[model samples]
Target chain A: MFFNMQLTYEIAGGDFGKAGYASSEIKKVLKKLNLDLRIIKKIAVALYEAEVNIVAHAYRGSLTVEIDTVKISVKAQDEGPGIADIDQAMTEGFSTASAQVREMGFGAGMGLPNIKKNADELNISSEVGKGTELEIITYLK
Target chain B: MEAQTFHHALTILTDVCIGCTHCMQVCPTEALRVKNGKAELFDNRCVDCGECMRVCPVNAIIVEQDDFSEIFKYKYRVALVPSVFIGQFPRDIPTRGIYSALLEQGFTHVYEAEHSAELLRESINEYITEYEDKWPVISTFCPAVVRLIQVRFPSLLDHMMQLKPPLDLAAMSYKKHLIDKGHNSDDIGIFYVTPCAAKIAAVKSPVGDESSPINGVINLNFLFNKTYRTLKNNDREQCPIPEKEQLKDFEMTWTLTSGESTHVNRRSLAIDGIHNVIEFLEKLENGEVTNFKFLELRACDESCAGGILTVENRFLTRDRLHNRAKQYLKDVSEGKRLHNKSIDQYKPYLKQHINIKSIPARSMLKLDEDMGEAMKKMERVRNLMCFLPAIDCGACGAPSCQSLAEDIVQKRAAISGCVFIQQSMQMKNKLSNDHALRIMEKTWGENRFDKDCTKKGAKDES
Candidate 1:
């Protein structure tokens, strides 16, 4: 039987300073689990980019991370302005970020592209008026 | 995954330690714990920062050093003195007087540790440019910080520059200088006058490289006292030593804060103090802190001036080094030509030996080698954590409730070792009072609970 664990963190949007808290906590737990450094690095980048994306766009969100010997999974669910075009949003330099957000060094539009490159699998679903849900997974075995 | 264990120069003498928990509170890595009426070290977790020694009430923690007589074994004895060692002396004592004192203390020759700092800066700039992909190249100058990164921040291992620090390069240059002068390598000894235990440990069991060029380490505090007595003697024999070139303006403060960062061509930040470094590194790892091309991180607060073994105040030492550097600049502007022994001549050989092997990451956070086993232990620790108090009182001999739970899951301690759990068990008639007392006695030795007037700050402390 595979040993599994789950961790959840509440993310407050628009607070750029408080972003990446969830990613760091997840990284600490993964380090303690004796995971491969390369896998951990991949997870760190993907999870961090996703975590920052929610802060850069949404009003509020929550992150749930599931870790096991076979695979690791992270899902970011946020309640705010959602992406209208998924394919276009995934393109590099295709940022819809405001001047203020861009000034903060976030919302480079490389968020989805980075998450796509680092994660083993990526899932995205959203409504225009509502929030967006992003699922990112990486296999360990 | 690395088989080589970390070597620590600090020793906790149980005979002298009273299990006061002063040291247990200050360890940055949580490597120290009170056990059996004494503090014990977890070698892998300890980076030898010497913070514990700084806070120990009884001065029970000691940084080990080579015996003075040991230097006599080599025909050509060399003391590689760092600038901080000179910073400890009063401003009135000239650098030449200190050098003479070292010679009188059985050293045949002396070499300044930062003589290679000039070369080190050039090499570091080249390395930063060559490895452009690895932005924010972390300096490997501080050995304690190197070990800290190895154990705690293993993921950031790639960022650590493979280049050796000035001390290592200086030692290599000194050894080569002696060997080139027809002295056998075996007959030459290079001892470092270190300001902290971390340097002692680095010389003994170096990281990134196979072996250190240093033959031994002499703690700064011990050597300071030895020279202080010699300087006080008015009738002391004088050694008419040749005038060797002292540190240049930038080189004098090379070991101080902002020394490396001030010289680097690109964007760089100098972070001193172990806790500050940890906080900044946490942000860097999560991609929060960015844009810096290089980071010069030191473990001590004021860089080497705040070394644990240093006798003088850190601020005073820093001021002295700054003044010393200013004085050197004034001398240069007055057309005083610096004499001889230029380390710049050996750049070819120093460059060849400066690049160290890649530093491997060794995560101390892992509960076990296998991922499956580590997951199991993590689960057990989480389960145990629920019943334990989170106050982090060191009564359980472990540093905190979390660590005690971890120790219990690893079978190094028992859940009943917790006083709260013992009290509850006694209330439920599951544990006898005598049994609880025995458990405590086991954790903290017998008679540890007895009232003693000789404890720190007590009336009969003498």
Candidate 2:
């Protein structure tokens, strides 16, 4: 029989050091579930990039994750200047992160694209001045 | 191996990780992550390169090497020495002096790995020259680097040089040497004098398509004291050379990262230390530089001299090796001749490979389709983190406030598991049940915890 878990993380912004918080927690949850290795990795990559985005751009954010017998789902919402051009931001080479973030070895512009590649289904909604919300789904079956 | 099987390999000190993600940031395999205020290591994905062990500021991560007592079970012990051993001692000390010392220390046979290293070097260059169309021919000298490439950049497996590691090459060559003298292979136990713990782990559980040719590992530090005593005595017989031309020293020079660059007979870029190597290789994976035909990478800074397990100072070791290499090359022709002879007599050891498949990492995601419970847990995590100071000091029973919150939410831990949170609760006289309910109510908002969320019920009284 398969089991399900729901996890949550309150990611604080303005901290470059604590960037991958939500993603790391999700990885721990997946490990305990004994999901397929491939699916676990995909969820981890997508969720982590999303978390980093919130910390880098938002003032504060929260991550909500849902896991079941055959599938995993994640939703990240942040209070920040939402993405102006969703298509451009999703592009592999498009990045808006500052020089400081790059020095720490992040802001590679590959974050969004990598997230896209890892998730089975991904949705992003943003209103330039409002905020940003991301939803991701990955299936193990 | 499954993640469940390797669970014991995960070591989270809880207090010292600082949640910096330095290990996670640099891990080529993406086996680490920072949650809350501490770093968590994934067991299934970790290859145990000791990068975390080396980079941690508080010495929180630890990867221990197997003891020499493992060698006691074997009847015939053969010592396989890497070429870098030449960089360890003074130039005046005869190389065979070290060999004789190993004999006194219970090893039955000694082989200078540089002989195989030279042979492997020549073979790799020839392979590169023949397959010149293969743009970047990655060196196979560092087992840890090979693991990184295989795990993080699987598509670039074609870029790796087909040759086995020098120690493996030397072990196979020695097995053949013993066979020619009418000895059985199983009777002789081959032990590599390793520069790092990765090599020891590699010997125990090798990656990729090959099994380790050597049976065991002996760190340089463990063997140094005894060998040094022998160097002072100047007593035992010299190493039995199969050929008179094999004893020349330059063949032993490839101990450092740049050591292979010199032997490759071409312009090559050498990188040592973990962070720099990861960056350059990532660039390579992205096809950043196409012109550089050869690249030598080492995980430790100062090449092998700065290895994770070495006892000597890396800077001092580098200077000593540089000075000694200069003094040994007085006769350039002899150096070239010695290098050529070692190559002509090379042997390959091929063994049955045991697949070490990757395992899934544990998820911190929700256990049910209940968003209501997840929201409640998020609120709990938020409250804990606010009280956390974000120092990730790891004093809490969990790795971080985030981790503690996950535990609390999942019923694996409690909010009071956080010492800081508990202390704050005590200071405010809010450790009572009513205050705990109030803390939850305030963080999650009034309508936050629905009947669906309370389906699991509250397990922690606090």
Candidate 3:
């Protein structure tokens, strides 16, 4: 089915103050759509974790969200130094965050795991010396 | 469906309101709005925290509590005194004197809310131990905070501790005590000497229960002068009231901030002040604040002592409470523990069937009534926000730039309401008008055209 609506947001890297703005806005949109609270919660958790990952690691990122009758799809692409090993990074308690980021409690290595747990489907693609892109889809049910 | 009746404990007198926007600015829930040059409250959105009452400079906002005279209607009147009310008096007055003063004022019996708080404390400990997996269990004692969760944090509703507030529990315990003493339940009326407007509302319309055990709420400030007079007129030589054992230090400190958590004695967080609580709740909802078993959130700045209806200064009252608690602890250490078995005897009055229902989101904040249209309008609002100055000056009659953007999209307001937009539009129109006149002058040679056009018009008329 065609998407009923779409929204996009620009996220600046290291901008901790506004890290969750996009996810919160999407959450509000989903709430207005009258989706199940549990579904909205899962989407919020997944999107927020992905958004924060971009802010913490990437130089800049853009999040594009599409909502349809059946599901919500989110695509986040960032311009920054790419991950060296996807498998290692996805492991719990594995982090390459700076000391400053760790101090701010962002480098718990739970971000990807949390996103994976909440999203129905998650796709990650990255190239060395390039940027990273994450695609997350959550069913309305 | 029948419309739900909300308790408007805090009301604004429209005639006295100055429309200064101070209350609207400070409101944590964004419940207040300056409409038609007056402050208006959305009843469903308001939590009756008395924040507006405190910020209103003209004293237009008033807390509507039950009249103290209403207690006379009942044959048996019981006063449920909050711990904060006891700390409001001078330090020299013995706590027993306050009890006797209540009795002298025609109350058949007076029960301290602290006792109920102790019971609730025990219940909470048991609840935490049993539901150990439910991390970050929020306190349900503050009616305003509970209502806030209902309105703003509906997702966190399940996290709320399902227990009756101290005031309600106290009334229940008092009723049982009176009934055990052979007085009929129907003849007795329970009155809560409340420190805040939220408590008054709670008594009138309880959160979890269909009706409250508390029949009426008398504001502490309203009864302060009368209680003081009663204490002053009493003869010191004739002490008719027996001295009861002082409350434990932890129970006595229940009226102040962080007091509730000190009893939990675990990984807990105590957040006071509505704004601070809102901030913490947002973090909590986002899964930022974890590893804590309990969260004691109070809507008032210094908890109950900072209530708007209280007469005494909070800091001073807090100090006095601490001193009294220290004395009570010293007495307890001397093998003088008060044997109050009521805590163990009575169970919580919270009904197993009834629970607090979460309220729906306020429609006033919605961009459109239709979800699809709202999404479209949300996009438009985003575009409008880009053009806005983002200064949140409130010059456009909206609280912030983002709100103005929403108002513009809702068609309740026009983009021209923004001063910057209005000035730019005016300038653009002026520049265009000037350009049109300049073109007319250049094409028609100013004076020559006026003369030639007039002559030609006269010839054509002839």
Candidate 4:
């Protein structure tokens, strides 16, 4: 109603074959929105990393993206084992992925770090054994 | 960024087009739209790949060419022929006969278009070695692929190798040779016998380079028919055709599929056909493809052998070229020095001027120049999509329903173009029956639904 656009996608867990589908779709829309290619690529990479994190480490997840003229905000909520130490999880090369997931190359522990690097803002909250909610925001300007 | 004024060689004969929508259905870029009983082309979106020409039933799509007599104006008329054209002759027609036939057709000299392909290969290897960060370098060999990247995948333009194609190098080398031999530049006219519409477009409007060295272009089908008839009708044995140096084994098959990839001294992939190239480029843009140092992206199925202007079957021409290459290889192994003296002598000069200045991406994907306006328009497009059927039926004259929606938002078309919507409005008494018929006729043609027995495949056809 305020001239803001929003998109939501239901991402299935453990479906590594389809991890990048949502990110690809989002990239297409952003391209149509005439965003700079550099910004679109950064958003796509960060969204893909977040989506793959859900597939490799969670039961299931949903991603919601809010778009305005000034900025874009993404929130990913997953139902799975939560991170104990968010700082440690954010550290590069600090992956808690299973041996199988690592072998498949899905769990590069740079997920949270990369999101923070590409996005202008990042926030994380989780319960011990419940789930995790990751929020990322990037300014359009 | 490059300017939006693209010179396309493919021209649709509007009077001859029957609004069949065949070309619209198969276009890879959705650049075609049928209106007023003829298919219209969006100049910026068309890459001149000639898929429309391939599918047109009534030969309405045609590639423009220089007049045949245009070569006669100059004292030195050089016929720059592609290897695919050479492979079109029958078995009885010898290679020398092909050259003699060209000589008979007012050409003072003949040269293979891929003569400098070897030199081009060396330059590409050096560039790939120097610029490892720009891995998976897409070849600018296919002019259609170069234009495709300019329009659809602007971001990947950095990965394009900034080098002129073999045809340009060949033309440059020959021109330099003629000048060195004391021929006046004004008197020399280099005409290329093009295998496809894309090359003709490239010759007319070169990208990444200042201007094409070729002065004119002759359609492959037109030239091939003339030469074939000449070789078949007359006794060419007495034609003093010298035993000139043959094309190297590599040069002979350079126009075939996978030919360029195999020559590249890198981990490369050769993808042919416009659709296949588009799919692979999409994966490349998405970061799915890796470890490739080179990409030979061709717009035709069997490479230049499948050009729209070619006369022979693509497979047959490919086999003939390979067989010709095999003979050349056999001659090489038997101590024959089939060397091109001009190219070898002009190697340093060609190498010195090999690199293209710049190729800017003119992306056709963006809806508007401003991000805010594009976003607003995109929102409107999404809203319109909810009301339109996604069946992609071409009855509305646009290639797909999405195409119609975008056109509507752009104000180039209206929502009433959809037949289904017109029917719904008519049932609701919102539109008169005559108004609905008028809308359909406006899109399809005037009197399009009439019973004409003269049309193709009609029951009471003439």
User: Considering every candidate listed, which one attains the maximal TM-score?
Assistant: 1
RMSD of each: 3.0, 12.2, 11.5, 3.4
lDDT of 1 by residue, B226-340 (tens): 9999888858455647347687878889999999999899999999999999988878876666789999999999999999999999999999999999998888889884666
Candidate 2: list runs displaced more than 4 Å: A1-141, B1-47, B50-76, B122-140, B144-163, B235-251, B260-270, B277-297, B322-329, B332-343, B346-387, B397-414, B430-462
The lDDT, on a scale of 0 to 1, for candidate 4 is: 0.86
User: In model 2, what is the error at residue A11, expressed in angstroms?
Assistant: 17
lDDT of 3 at A138: 88
| Candidate 4 chain A minimal-lDDT segment of 10 residues | A33-42
Clashing pairs in 1: none
Which candidate leads the pack in DockQ? Answer: 1
Please state the CAPRI-style docking class of candidate 1: medium
Ordering by DockQ:
1, 4, 3, 2
Q: What is the per-residue lDDT of model 4 for residues B122-154, given as tens digits with 9 covering 90 to 100? A: 888999999997898889999998988888777
Ranking by TM-score: 1, 4, 3, 2
Model 4 chain B lowest lDDT segment of ten: B1-10
Per-residue lDDT tens digits for candidate 2, residues B37-136, read 4566555446556776676766566444346766666677777776455457765765556666677777776777766655666676776787676557
Say which prediction, candidate 2 or candidate 4, comes out ahead on DockQ: 4
TM-score of candidate 4 relative to the true fold: 0.93
- Pick the lDDT winner: 1
Cα error, residue B318 of model 2, in Å, equals 2.8
